[model samples]
Target: MTFQDYFPIWNKLQTDQQDRIRSNLNFRTVKKGTILHNGDMDCTGLLLVKAGQLRAYILSDEGREITIYRLFDRDLCLFSASCIMRSIQFEVTIQAEKDTDLWVIPAEVYQDIMETSAPVANYTNELMASRFSEVMWLMEQVMWKSLDKRVAAFLLEEASIEGSSVLKITHEAIANHLGTHREVITRMLRYFQSEGMVRLSRGMVRLLDEDRLRQLQD
Candidate 1:
């Protein structure tokens, strides 16, 4: 798809502004596990996902990673250019969760356009607000939700996303996404298996009773 196709506000900008963006945008392909942005300071620019999956996460002082949000095809990522929003300072890291294709708009170029284009500025604010809401929701989950319910919700969500009950994901990976330890995930999985809600093997968890899982989540 063309840049215009992916960008919802393409027609909102003036022709010159559109030209500036088109000229400055770059196409990049990243392998799964590639780190696209490392920290708060690197102004890697805004990422527009063309295909595949991406993850946005933060690290604890002890060096454990926890996912904040995930991106799929046609998603726009503003945190990659967090420098543009001077007030907020978060040590967020973005990585390719699957082999992906993306469009990178230089931070300076996009910022410049935002200065003169009301639509661009408004669109940016909307994106930033949406991201902040996700972060807030995550904080609520981590603080108030039980791990078992969280795990069940995550499993059901993953199953929906992959369109399968057999999840080809490791315990450690689930821990990383949920911001817990591998041992915790393993213990929980074992508990679920014993209850017949799931059947766990080397690197997969098959849902035996999704209704039970959903009930637990509820």
Candidate 2:
């Protein structure tokens, strides 16, 4: 498939507009752990994932990391082209969470097209709004939800994403996602084990009671 196949408004674009985007599109493959965009310093173009996963996160002054949102197959990430969005003030880092295939549309080229195309501008604004909504939801989760509930929710979300009860993720990784510490996650996992909610082994956490975990998350 091509970018047109994944982009919803591709057919609405004029021939020249389509040609300009096609000419500037870049196909890329990245390995897991590769940092594609480094905060606000690198204005890496808009990324459209063809396969695998990408994680968008922000780091605090003290170096703590919290995930803002994740991009899966067919997902379009607009924040990578932060320079195009003048309203975006904070820095965000994007990394490959798995071996990934994607296409990047050059920011300058896309911005130029947006200036002449109302449809493209509208689509870009909608995408930006959706990303901000996800960030707002994460803030609410962190503010009002307890650690145990957050952990349970994360585990369940991971299970659904990976299509399994056993999650191959480390305590430190979970802490990084939730913006907490390794020791705190370890303590919470031990408590979950005591309650027979999960079974931990080395770098894995296997869900034992899905119903109980869902209840706790609620």
Candidate 3:
């Protein structure tokens, strides 16, 4: 599929604008663990995911990492083009969670189009609002929810995303995502294991009781 297939306002753009975008678009295929965009210093352009998964995360001063959001097939990531949005001060890192195919529209070209096209500017604003809403929801979760509940919710969410009950992930990875220490996650997993909610193995955690986990999340 092409950028026209995923971009909602593509049909509204002028012929010349569309031609410029199509000509300048950069297609990339990255392996898992590849860092696509690092901090605010890099303007990596707007990424449109064609396949696989991408993760948007932030790192604390002491080196703790926490996921802000995730992107799947057909997802549009505007944060990668942070140079065009001067108001965004914090650094957000974009990485390939799995082997990914994507198309990137250059920030300068997109900004120029937005300057002339009201529809493009409006659409960009709407997208930014939606992303900010997701970030706000995450902040609420972090502030109001307990750690156990947060871990349970994260596991359920991960299972749904992967479409499996058995998760092939390490405690350290989970801690990194949740912005906590590895020992804390290990202890929580042990508690969950004792309660018969999960079974922990070498580098995996199997959900034995989804109902209980769901209850904890609620």
Clashes of 1: 0
Worst lDDT run of 10 residues, candidate 1, spans 82-91
lDDT of 1 at 90: 78
Each prediction's whole-model lDDT (CA)? 0.93, 0.94, 0.95
lDDT of 3 at 58: 95
In order, what is each prediction's RMSD in angstroms? Answer: 0.8, 0.7, 0.8
Error of 2 at 204 (Å): 0.6
- Cα error, residue 66 of model 3, in Å, equals 0.6
Badly placed stretches (over 4 Å) of model 2 are none
For candidate 2, what is the total of clashing residue pairs? 0
RMSD of 1: 0.8
Q: Model 3, 1-218: lDDT tens per residue?
A: 67799888999999999999999999999999999999899999999999999999999999999989999998899999999999999999999999999999999999999999999999999999999998999899889999999999999999999999999999998998888899999999999999999999999999999999999999
lDDT of 2 by residue, 127-191 (tens): 88999999999999999999999999999999999999999999999999999999999999999
**Residue 65 lDDT (model 2):** 93
Query: Candidate 2, after superposition: displacement of residue 26 in Å?
Result: 0.6
